[model samples]
Target chain A: MPSTAEPDALSAGAKRGRPGYDQDSVLNVAVQVFNKHGYDATSMGLLAENLGISKSAIYHHVPSKGDLLRLALDQALVPLEAISEHERARTGTAEERLEFFLRSTIRVLIERQPYVTLLLRLRGNTEIERTALERRRAVDRKVADLVVEAQREGTLREDIDPRTTTRLLFGTINSMVEWFRPDGPAGAQQVEDNAITMMLDGLHTRNL
Target chain B: MPSTAEPDALSAGAKRGRPGYDQDSVLNVAVQVFNKHGYDATSMGLLAENLGISKSAIYHHVPSKGDLLRLALDQALVPLEAISEHERARTGTAEERLEFFLRSTIRVLIERQPYVTLLLRLRGNTEIERTALERRRAVDRKVADLVVEAQREGTLREDIDPRTTTRLLFGTINSMVEWFRPDGPAGAQQVEDNAITMMLDGLHTRNL
Candidate 1:
């Protein structure tokens, strides 16, 4: 519920991120708080109080709290869902496709850093969260299969299990969400190039 | 909190894992639940119910919920702290030390998977958690310094910033918690070896 002492600034009916209590504005705030407090730890009262609106106002935009979670989950996974459609991810040589997928993934993560980080932090407390986690694993399995194919082609090494390799590669990539800063030392492109190099070439200086 | 239905399964003095609500038993159950549900989402009532003990009984051992968190955080970091003092990690060349740190970290992670995973999942919901996060970052920074040392000695590549390199290295290692089953197809030694190889040699068939 809106506090009676709501700031003087907000009394004039400041513009909602849209004309009404739009899903986008609500999501922007929800993601921030949910990211801060684990999803289940957050409460409708908290969201309403933060929005300086009654719980009914948020209800006006979305049916329940779960709806906001679903939208945030979508914000994180939808781009990767498009990854399989990328020409390179679809029909390019296994390594080429893997490269495209890696490069494209980094771009998506940086662009949607907050949502992606929120996605990683989710503990599957609810069906929506669990589904997001499952969808993430599915995307990983798809990438693992490509790693297996590349290994079959003798491009990527098979010494590690395809699943293991995929996990490690992703582990490295996903960790970026924890620390990657757009305004920090490296630009997204720089981080992308370095990551691809580390994954493909590794840390040590190579000698043929 | 013992139910009247406290099955004949638990005899009167069979005891709740030790004597009158031992911290160890309480912790063993607490860590499991904390790992399942992020810390902030978990509560004293839930922990008590799961342990099948009265809340006051648990309170008999640990003073507060934060104490349990501190214990779990210790479980995850203490081993790595020991690793830093290992001969190889301490006195070896930068590259050698980095390698030792990586291998040791993977071993420790596998050995302490659940708590370590919980440690990583924590978003510093409390001051104790934030301190844990800071300590973990401090460890990463020390490792990053080693990486910079290696680069200076021309043993490792320098194109990427050392901090990024450190995060990537950790991201890869920390990911082991996500899917590595100790009893899975690849044993810990096998996974560790493959990870080291990949880090040293890379994924593709090299043609340097």
Candidate 2:
């Protein structure tokens, strides 16, 4: 009888069948298709067609659609997770810590663009999606806790609720997925810098 | 051969045992159902079942799923259209006018919460969605223009691009649809006030 790890063994065993089609290649294609057609709307047939491969051939790499989603979300989750544990994020003044987290989060989104796009779009209709959502929200809560602490230290404005501030702060960053084309004039670093500047200084000039 | 102008005639000619239901009530039910299950995933059968009406009765109010989508998009578009023509939106200092436009836009969103939720969730896969998205982008351009004017006038910071600022500003407001529960402690006004404060004051506190 095959063990529970048999699927992984089977997927890894086929190292040369598809010629340059590894787990990463499959995931790249799957994430693109998922972003375009939506996770629920995408079918294995459509995915196979997009990959220019047969259904069984595609199955050799990933177990199912949900596994691809898991892989995609994990790639996006790592950067934000890193920020929570990073030394700079932990050992700075409230303002500096908050800034580090924000800049790091944006850098992660830029680096893992497609994965984070898929991560932000998950609607929780599937167990994989719900788990991804919970993990992302935990990341958000960690940042929100930092912001709340910043507010308590009289660094951030006290009028707005910390939760709302967190949403607005991340909302500005998340909406970039919808409009921020990679081929634009501004590079990712510039985008991150400008976003941090806006969050920190706002639109109005400091004098007025 | 009754004219479509006659609401009573439309109601009477509606194919159902219950003659009281109009297009408005059926649309209300359809929007609610659509919000729960998404526009593409929702079936006419499910909407009819939820409405306690027959498929033909549902069809009498709207020709197809696209028609219902058009109606929902119209609700969101109407407010923006109004804001464009608003006198205050045209005449104030760029920052003040933009604030007025944003505050009004938020009020409209809260008032038309469900329809706006549907509009915001739309992906431009279909002609109807594409047109709605184009109009949304046009409204964004108008706001971006205001930001640019403010920058020129030395009211707003010059470092950030006006277009990115507009996206983040509107994105922050639009995200209210995702987490906001009307049943929560903060009502729409409170939310608006906080959003205004955040947009104007930002997350960081200044000595001034």
Candidate 3:
């Protein structure tokens, strides 16, 4: 995934006197606006006004508002799909692999929060959204599979159903998007560690 | 709180030749449409169309779409506020009280899933939304206080920050709105039990 922070090399090279915004920068602003206003309520005019660029300038980057939506959704989904298919996520002991998956998913959520937030709120009103939802479900199923494997391996508790375990675990992690600020009083590392400990060790004080 | 399943007695009594809907039923359909299409995007025409009633019929129930928004939001918020202020929630040991809060919260979220879903998705774009957001924050602070008391009483582990713990615990519980079907294989009782066990006991197998 291209970092929104870096200049878009391809766009920069292709256009002479390109508007001050690159595709990544436009996407960054678009995701922010989509998040602030409901996606269905956002228009290209509103997006351009927020971008401080002409409608034609935005068109220079992407063909339509739908294209921006697709790009923005990919920003969140691609990394998550990568995590599910990562060699380490695939090869480790189920317990080890599950931890890696949880930790990695948290990092992705924090890094791509705006994108992920938009992705989560999607209602599948369009074909692009439905396709994105499918990819998201596929990732969810992979994580659930890991939970099942962990339970079967006896490294994790078997009392709780694995699918329920996956849902609760991801639910806890995803809830962070509501209030977690990368620059908040709690650093990302602290938030991640606290979640891991709470998930693995439970919140009760151990007698031993 | 009046159950949506029950007819709206006041509205039923007030009107002659009342449309086939009551206030609770109108609010119920309004909340569903809002959840599906979003609060801002939904208009009275769309709502009336979905409800198979005239726009006048919807207006008979509520003065304006904004009124419906406030009413729908309150349907979710009022119950949550009551939970925080419930006598049992206030009287028990912090650990026991916290458990009650969690269990009661899960029950409310399930019973009022659509309303709560609408509440959670509020963007605070209007005065009513901002007010609802404030009420939500207040409830969160109360829950966090219970966590602080639990940790101080040596029931909950001290390593995690009480506020973060509260957020994660509620985050885990609040997440049930996403995919937890009341009619699904897992009953509400099972979901409540699994969440309580996961939150209090951790998910790892006990070695002792």
Using DockQ, give the best candidate's number: 3
The DockQ values of the predictions, listed in order, are 0.58, 0.50, 0.62
What is the per-residue lDDT of model 3 for residues B104-153, given as tens digits with 9 covering 90 to 100? Answer: 88988999999999998888989999999999889888889888888899
Candidate 2 achieves a global lDDT of 0.79
- In order, the Cα lDDT scores of the candidates are 0.79, 0.79, 0.84
Candidate 2 — which pairs collide?
A: none
Point out the worst 10-residue segment of candidate 1 chain B by lDDT: B1-10
- lDDT by residue for model 2 (A5-29), tens: 1223335334565554668767878
CA displacement after TM-score superposition, residue B19 of candidate 1 (Å): 3.4
**lDDT by residue for model 1 (A1-208), tens:** 2231233333222354323345666777788778776688789889887777788777877899899999988998999888988777888689989889889888889998878988887767788888999999888888888899998998887677777788788888988998898889888888898888788887787532
Better of 2 and 3 by DockQ: 3
lDDT of 1 by residue, B1-208 (tens): 2331233334432354435344555666788888776687679999888878788877776889999999878988889778887878888688899898889999999998877888888877689999998988777877888899999988898777777778788888988898799889888998898787766667887633
- The runs of at least 3 residues in candidate 1 whose Cα sits more than 4 Å from the true structure, single-residue gaps closed, are A1-21, B1-23
Error of 3 at B130 (Å): 2.0
- Give the lowest summed-lDDT range of ten residues in model 3 chain A: A1-10
Cα displacement (Å) at residue B150, model 3: 1.1
Whichever of 1 and 2 has more TM-score, that candidate is 2
Q: What is the lDDT of residue B60 in candidate 2?
A: 77
